[model samples]
Target: MNPDIISVVIDKLRKLSPEKASDLTVKNAQFITLQSLDLDSLDTLQLAMDIEDALGMNIEIVNFPATLTIGQLSEHLAEMRAELREPA
Candidate 1:
């Protein structure tokens, strides 16, 4: 699950902002933020849509704070997934 979250996030980040191969790695993503990625509001919306499509979870932009990091986003998504798996 951890790997999946990180991989999806990394893939989306790369696709959204096509940097060099050396850029946007899991190690760097720990501190990378949406703002730093030059992801505007539209880019963010696209990211959310892509994530929902890929993971089947409704992770909305409004659900996050202004300053959001990729690592934090991955962690939040993991929590959401865990909640879905819990017996309600």
Candidate 2:
């Protein structure tokens, strides 16, 4: 995953869950689940929405796996961004 993209995601995560953000780091976040960050379904949904708004893209949540990690999610979003820039 792009480090820049990961940083942006981490910043958004911090805004959404400041309590858990302090403990999160790019290296450790690769293996941690959203649930481990104390984010419930609603929080996750809100996070997704916030990410979309921040990045200005329509990310299909259905494409996300059930057991998603922060690294994987960041990689996926980066891929989606690349796809969007491709000539149609």
Question: What is the C-alpha lDDT profile of model 2 across 1-88, one tens digit per residue?
Answer: 7887788778888887898877667987688666667776677777788888888998766644547788888898999999999999
The 10 consecutive residues of candidate 1 with the worst lDDT sum are: 60-69
Q: lDDT per prediction?
A: 0.80, 0.78
Q: How well is each residue in 1-88 modelled by candidate 1, as lDDT tens digits?
A: 3889878988887888997335778887677777777777888898888988899888878855547777888888889989998999
The reply for model 1, stretches above 4 Å from the true place, is 64-66
Candidate 1 pairs with clashing backbones: none
Off by over 4 Å in 2: 63-66
TM match of model 2 to true structure:
0.84
Residue-pair clashes per prediction, in order, are 0, 0
The residue-level lDDT of candidate 1 at 30 comes to 73
